[model samples]
Target: MKAVILAAGYGTRLLKDLQGADEQHLQDLTGTPKPLLPIAGFPLISYWIEALRGGQDPIDIFIITNELYQGKFKDWAKNYPFVTVISDGTSTNEERLGAVSCLQLIIEAFSIDDSLMVIGGDTLFYEDFHLQDVVEEFEVLYRGNNQANLVLSYTCKDDETKKYGIVETDESSRIRAIKEKPSPPETASRQACPCFYLFSRHTLPCVKEFLNEKKDAPIDEKDAPGHFLSWLVTRRPVFSTSIAGRFDVGNLESYRLCNKYFQENIRKLNYLQ
Candidate 1:
């Protein structure tokens, strides 16, 4: 399967904390756009590439970035044979396409039709978890006549429901409702949407439909992926799978936590060597 990484955002929220770090340090320090930032002495994206390498399928990676970071991403990905980087030019959040739009761009550009895995560039996860397994299961469900997309849900231990897209699922693991940080009393469970998603070819039409309908409306928020998935679940049979571990590098506290986790667990990751 192929993976498309959404990395075009400026990550302005993380700049202050990451100012003095080197490339790799910048990545681990803030979970920002610097994919080359160091995590345990290797580039941040390197870990993801290595994890995909361990998958059963031949994983092809495409990183979407803005013009300013394209050259850096190319340089960072040079040693990885299965990775490619594309620049979306210098566009603001409003001017540029969001995660879903970037996925569509990659699909059209590469002519990809098979199942695709979409991940946020800044997310960190356990190396032992085989992302391909998720993709394979998603393919199975799709072939079994399941007509919706797959969302990787992570159980959050905190009361920070306001920080994420919350999910409510039925006993069969089918998504019953998804809210982008709904009021606390309305939340069904702590299961929240991480940045990972598996989509079949069937999802493209839904995306196109969403885009067509959204073209006339004004965007008030920046959660593009959440908006897309919300639209998909409303029209199709969306299912949820739990991620073993998930870390968000965007927030200051989570960024620090991820760095600490990596430091303590570095030896577990063979990719560094």
Candidate 2:
């Protein structure tokens, strides 16, 4: 399987938050890309690299970043021989290829024909997250039906539902629809879908078709991967699996909490060994 890490976001909100932070430890984060921000003792993206490397599948990591920070990612990737850094040729936030576009770009640029696994570079999950398990689940679904696509979901607080792409699933747990940041939600389900997804190789062409259909539309049309996913569920059989939880480093409070939990998780694991 191949893994695509979407790290092209401009981190405008994160940078803005950092600007007002009084903590000395977080001061250096003013100009840093969200993925490159340090957590525990290493860059946030490095934890993903470590976790993916620990997985059973031989996943080739493809990190998609903007031209502004491509060199930074490239430098950090030097020790991980399995990783390759690619720039979307956009120097500024306005020029960025949206997450969906960046995903399609890496797929085309790398000529990947295998089952694809996509994850957000700025997010990490609880210690129980196993890439191999997700890959195995995808393999089972794909073998049963080649068109199967999988997405990860987690239950968040009811009030927090409006901040994420809420996925509504049928009784069988097959995803019925995805609602993007709906205030006073359009659906009753609290399944918040993160950026993690597994797509069978046969479903790859559909990405291009989706993009082509929205070529002239506003960038918002393709900005969130959830938008594409919402459209995708209508045409194909997409399913969801619940995870313990995930930490989205979108703001200062989240980053602090995630870093603390991650550090403790690592320390506990080391103690157990």
- Top candidate, metric TM-score: 2
Runs in model 1 lying further than 4 Å from the true structure:
20-32, 91-94, 219-223, 269-273
Tens-digit per-residue lDDT, 64-112, candidate 1: 9987677778877778767889987665655666666677778878888
CA shift at 120, candidate 1, in angstroms?
0.4
**Model-by-model lDDT, in order?**
0.73, 0.86
Residue runs of model 2 more than 4 Å from their true location after superposition = 268-273
What lDDT, from 0 to 1, does candidate 2 have? 0.86
Using all chains and alpha carbons, the TM-scores for the candidates as numbered come to 0.87, 0.95
Give me the displacement of residue 232 in model 2, in angstroms.
0.5
In Å, residue 5's CA in model 1 sits off its true spot by: 0.9
Clashes of each: 4, 0
**Candidate 2 C-alpha lDDT tens digits along 1-273:** 888999999998888899989986687778789999888878988877877777655779899999999999988888998899999999999897799899999999999898888889888887667766787888899999999999999988878878999988999789988888876546788889998999988888889999999999899889888889999999889999888889889998899998898777876532122
lDDT, residue 170, candidate 1? 93
